[model samples]
Target: MQEEFISVWVRDPRIQKEDFWHAYMDYEICLHTNSLAFNKKSSCVRRRYSEFVWLRQKLHDNALLLAHIPELPPKNPFFSLNNARQITARMEGLRFFLEEIVRCPVLLSDSCLHLFLQSQLSVKKIEACAEGRSRYTVAEAIQSSGCRVQRFCSEEHSQEEGETDSE
Candidate 1:
């Protein structure tokens, strides 16, 4: 059996303006993995807090009988991007959420999770993509659906380099 390895980072928070009065903090979710469970080796998607809520609810609904769902960062109506502490707290919270979910094989297998991490699809479209109604697979969706697919050195190679530097 091949060892499965996956890592996720929630970073690069930026406020997105939908209009003058409507704006929200958006995060860039970056993923790297060697697991075939994921369609891509590396990908990034920008998502807002609402999207994280949707994902948590969906995963909870799906796994209610099977596993414990992790809590998301508390929703703060007064979230200010200008506040460094608030930004750091939210980013760390979001990152912790992904790290916990990826550690669970049951949660890791959800198509919604795949789409959330790798594709730039809306909640509705992510459901559609998972259901085979969409034309693109998660890999193809990342390539064509505005998500960013990044290329990084393999984890093994990076680890070896770190060891050499320490020697």
Candidate 2:
């Protein structure tokens, strides 16, 4: 039997016009379930940045390695909400975040992460309480879960290694 693959993407984020100038603009951080898994229905859940943050925090609190959590794009205070380039970059970052969550088996089993990816709740009420096992911190989780992580080498170092090793 083939393993189920979860495909996710972020689409059409609208900036809240009223919050555009409040030093922090609200973002429509959504995940669309382009579900490639068998017998699963495709879904689109509308969420916000805070909800995403909360999910990451929950994972961290549960002792899940943050390296397993995908990074969100950095905030640009100088850029206006309507700037096309900035918006596009943010969307891409959100997409990356979802992709990373789907890729990690440990993260896939997390309740909070599951809701972030598969739940239909609105942003305001998107909290998932701890259930079942005692939630350990990232290090403990790593030790107990036996989840393996690849050493991450940056592109620059990779290029340098290729130059030296391949010569």
Candidate 3:
């Protein structure tokens, strides 16, 4: 039997400007998997810190009785993109939060988690999509929005095995 696994990487912090006075950092969330639970083989979506907070709250409220939800990184009111240390800390925190989330099977089955990881939809749209009110399925929304879908390569498995053998 093939081993089923999923890996999520949260990186590439880029600041998006809504207007002259408003700007915020968003990270590239890339997921690679052979797990049957996900709709796609791989996906990449850009999300801001606030979106992560919203996901955490949604998961907590919806799955509170089913599983233990992990806490997200503390919100920094004075967040600055220019600060290297702060960016690194937040990136690590966000990565850890996602890693922990994917570990829970109960959480893995949630539509909110699937939409958040797989599509570029806003929080409201994700909620709509999850509720079956949207015209597009998650995969269709992902394609329509032109979100990045990465192709997994067999070479990566060989490289991982080579590194493990050398270690």
Give me the candidate number with maximum lDDT: 3
> Best candidate per TM-score, number?
3
Q: Write the per-residue lDDT of candidate 2 for residues 24-83, one digit (tens) a residue.
A: 344433332334431223334556666667766677666446445667776565666668
Candidate 3: global Cα-lDDT? 0.82
Worst 10 residues of 3 by lDDT: 158-167
Residues 131-152 of candidate 1: C-alpha lDDT, one tens digit per residue:
8888777667766655445333
Task: Give per-residue CA lDDT, model 3, range 101-156, as digits (tens).
Answer: 99899998888898899888999999999888898876677556555453333424
- lDDT winner, 2 or 3: 3
RMSD in Å for candidate 2, one decimal? 12.5
What TM-score does model 2 achieve against the real structure? 0.59
Measured with C-alpha atoms, the lDDT of residue 10 in candidate 2 is 62
Q: Which residue segments of model 3 deviate by more than 4 Å?
A: 142-145, 150-167
Q: Under the 3 Å rule for N, CA and C atoms, how many clashes does model 3 have?
A: 0
Error of 2 at 1 (Å): 5.3
Distance from true position, residue 65, model 2, in Å?
A: 3.0
* TM, every model: 0.83, 0.59, 0.86
